[model samples]
Target: MKATLLSGIPLLIMTAIGIALIAQGKSADGRSTLAVGVIIAAVAGSSVIYQIGGWDLRRQSLAHFAIMLVTVLPALLLSGWFPLDSISGYFVVIAAFLAAGLVLWISFYLIFTKVVPRKADSSDAVRMP
Candidate 1:
């Protein structure tokens, strides 16, 4: 639930921006922006996979990253945000995508590991004196 809400924030913001763009007469760009936002939100919402029991952190992270990469690559390519005519454009987009993924992964790791408290197991619960 929390993950979904957090993910929706980006979608909401992008929807507003996309609508604005459409109003300004850039319908294609606006629609593409909306599509990208939806894709991002889907990836972000996949964070719930971390909450599933039985999966190790590494497995969960890899699964999530794979989901992000597969979904986002197509979204970006279809959005026309990068040039499609040249090999260099493809390379540049891939590079930027990797850099962004690294930064996001690091930020999420720090936030979840350091900032967010772990779920309190019954054995670790505090008792009244």
Candidate 2:
């Protein structure tokens, strides 16, 4: 619950800013802003899968990436950010998404495994440091 709320803060802020932009006539299409908000929410919410217990890091990361792809790909298409009729355009989008996901996954893996200490298990209790 706490994690969900914390993740939602950015979504709310971005939505407010998008609304402001639309109201000020800075943004041409309100639909585009809406699509962006959806994309942001999807990306933020997908991280929750990574926090689930009992899953190995690889499984969790794959689940997170799949969720992001499923949500964000459609949002991107609906946003009209690229040529919808072009196959190459979709390939580009997919490629970019994969690249970005890889970077984020690696960073999170390093942070959790390297920077954060794990809970001491029974093996640790028996073994000398």
Candidate 3:
């Protein structure tokens, strides 16, 4: 509960900042930064919630790595890191967001897995159902 609440703070702050920036004016650079920040906060927040819900660590780690790759890869590609320069800047940003979303989901999975583990019944019951 405490972890969840704490994680929410960063997300809330990012959301508020994004709203404020939008209200003032839709600056492209600002919007991009805001989007990234919001995404990060969401990932962190969701991770906490997953932990509170009880998940295993190994699985969670795999999930986290998957998500991070998904979220950051597109942006990196769009940034001209890749040989293919066909995609426009806007498209790059779009790809980045998609990746970020995937990353956040993975992050949540990881957090829950790491913090919450399965308990052993310590009993051998072989039944064919």
Candidate 4:
């Protein structure tokens, strides 16, 4: 809950700022900031899932990654915002998605499997020097 709030608050704030900026005629900057906020929110939300889902986090994360790859990127590309009709363009899109998913997975593995477990262990007793 705490991690979710911490992550979500920034997402909300940045999204608000993005809307405000767009209202003020700074559409480009506002859009970029809004995108950043969404990315941060997704990463933070993943952490919250780890906190809550226990054994199901991997499935959840992988599903989210796969959904984003199959739906989100194609939607963006077809929306005609970027030049993604060429072979190189498709390559760039795939590479970017894979890279993003890899980063997210690595972070999830390290935090949930490594750092969080260490913190939860009760065997951290101090030893005499």
Output the number of the lDDT-best candidate.
1
Best by TM-score: 1
The sequence of per-residue lDDT tens digits that candidate 3 reaches over residues 4-54 is: 565567656766776677787855444555555544654564454335336
Cα-based lDDT at residue 25, candidate 3: 88
What's the lDDT for residue 73 in model 1?
Answer: 72
CA lDDT scores, all candidates in order: 0.84, 0.75, 0.56, 0.68
Q: Write the per-residue lDDT of candidate 2 for residues 1-129, one digit (tens) a residue.
A: 754664587668767877887898867465577667777787777767767889987798778777777877777777767775879998987887778878977887799889999888877787668
Can you tell me which runs of candidate 4 are displaced by over 4 Å? 1-4, 63-91, 107-129
Model 1 TM: 0.72
Candidate RMSDs in Å, in order, are: 3.4, 4.0, 9.6, 4.9
Order of the predicted models by TM-score, top scorer first: 1, 2, 4, 3
What are the TM-scores, per candidate, against the unseen true structure? Answer: 0.72, 0.68, 0.41, 0.60
- Between the candidate structures 2 and 3, which one is better when assessed by TM-score? 2
Error of 4 at 85 (Å): 6.0
Off by over 4 Å in 1: 1-25
Q: Show the colliding residue pairs in model 4.
A: none
Lowest lDDT 10-mer window, candidate 2?
2-11
